[model samples]
Target: MIAAKRILRKAQRQLACRKRKIAIEEIMESKGDPTTFYKLVRQQRSSTSMGTEFLTLNGKTAESIEEVTQTWAQYFQQLATPTAESTYDDLHLGKIQDDINLINQICNSSHQDDIPTITKDEIHTAIYKLNNSKAADIFGITAEHFKLAGPSLITALHCVYNRFIKNQKIPESIKRGILTPIYKKGAPDNPGNYRGITVTPVILKTFEHIIRQRHQIILEETQSRLQTGFTKGTSPLVSARPTYRVHNRI
Candidate 1:
């Protein structure tokens, strides 16, 4: 009777495992549908409990949910806030004189050529090229919002970009960003295990895209051959060929 009972328990466990496998298979099959995929993921997560309820705070374990929440808040606040002892003068601006001089030379040279004006077509292209899946900024503006706004929004953005360029100023709206903490591989409760990523407005991204296009054109003409990373029509493999040949000869 005991052996029969054990067999029945083993069969029940196998049936449960089979059901879970089928559910996972269904989720994999529905990957094309993002909504369904995310829903399944949420359901899966809800079924499991995170083992970490307490967090280490200042060498002490936070026992309650309130304590954990407070500890996290304090951790983030301290991480974000600058130290009182640190001063701007302590940065030693003179150390970067050579870099500053080189940047000034580049700027002066670039200015000698006529500055490219922002266009509606460029703005439209930048907006349309933006990925819809990207996170929204503080204002909750996404690429999809701009795409739906159509030609009127594109024209307005073009005007704004040109105006900012002429005035030599950036708008406060563009300057502000939403910082989100992404968990990296480490202890779940450790604040150091997370990295903050800033999400800027899509409109600012569009403007940046236009500027980047112009900057790339200038870089292609003036950039050194030794600086190959992030350059178009070139790869690290192509850059390494010269070094590889030199090593072979040696």
Candidate 2:
């Protein structure tokens, strides 16, 4: 399986250092009581993502168990949907809104969706109102001047925000699947419009030596080395769900 193979490679990288010697006593200790041997097997699987939590008296070594389980769990956790509140920033929001306005106009939504067929005058008025709280000053006909659009603005806003939210999730998956893979394959003859793939070091190195090689701080590899100590084989050792949140008023 792809998951199993990925696990084996990772485990091989990590355990490369710990392959000194194992006495018969230690090997026998692993086999003595079926219960004890079983515990070690579970322990081996417990630290990885492969779902090998409990098993029969299995193979000579349990290399792939931990890595596969850990990787799969990580994949799912990254699959989590981000909340709208913490997901977008002011620049992103503004660009989204701008694009949406243009889209609505193109779709004839402004006319068909019952939104006032906004002229240059109305747009100017709204811009002034948006710029300052003096909405009444902008709109000459001002009783209790509060701008209201029909279905078009509402639909456009919702759709644009939805897309912006999706965009945040896109880069990572692209890096993991498409972008990183292309980078690893090397600079194409026509590297047209390729948003640089610096996501994975192994992939990124094909382009340039951006970060240090053979550093002790390789997060995934280091985490794998310390995985058994950090987790109950549930999730990766996370710091915290990103502490940064946009403070801008929507």
Top TM-score prediction, candidate number: 1
* lDDT value, residue 69 of candidate 2: 37
Error of 1 at 237 (Å): 1.8
Q: What Cα-based lDDT does every candidate model obtain?
A: 0.70, 0.35
RMSD of candidates 1 onward, in order = 9.2, 26.6
Candidate 1 regions exceeding 4 Å error are 1-114
1-250 per-residue lDDT for model 1 (tens digits): 9999989866764565455456566667778986685455445434252323456768877857688667767877887796655456645655666678998888666642256678888898888878765555678787789999988888788788888877666888678886544344456556676555566788788888888887888898899988778878877777788989999999
lDDT of 2 at 185: 21
Query: How high a TM-score does candidate 1 get?
Result: 0.62
Q: What does the lDDT read for residue 203 in candidate 2? A: 19
The parts of candidate 2 lying over 4 Å away from their true place are 1-11, 15-80, 84-88, 104-250
Q: Model 1 lDDT vs. the true structure?
A: 0.70
For model 2, which pairs clash?
A: 48-66, 48-70, 49-68, 49-69, 49-70, 50-68, 50-69
RMSD of 2: 26.6
What's the residue-level lDDT of 236 in candidate 1? Answer: 74
As a TM-score, model 2 comes out at 0.18
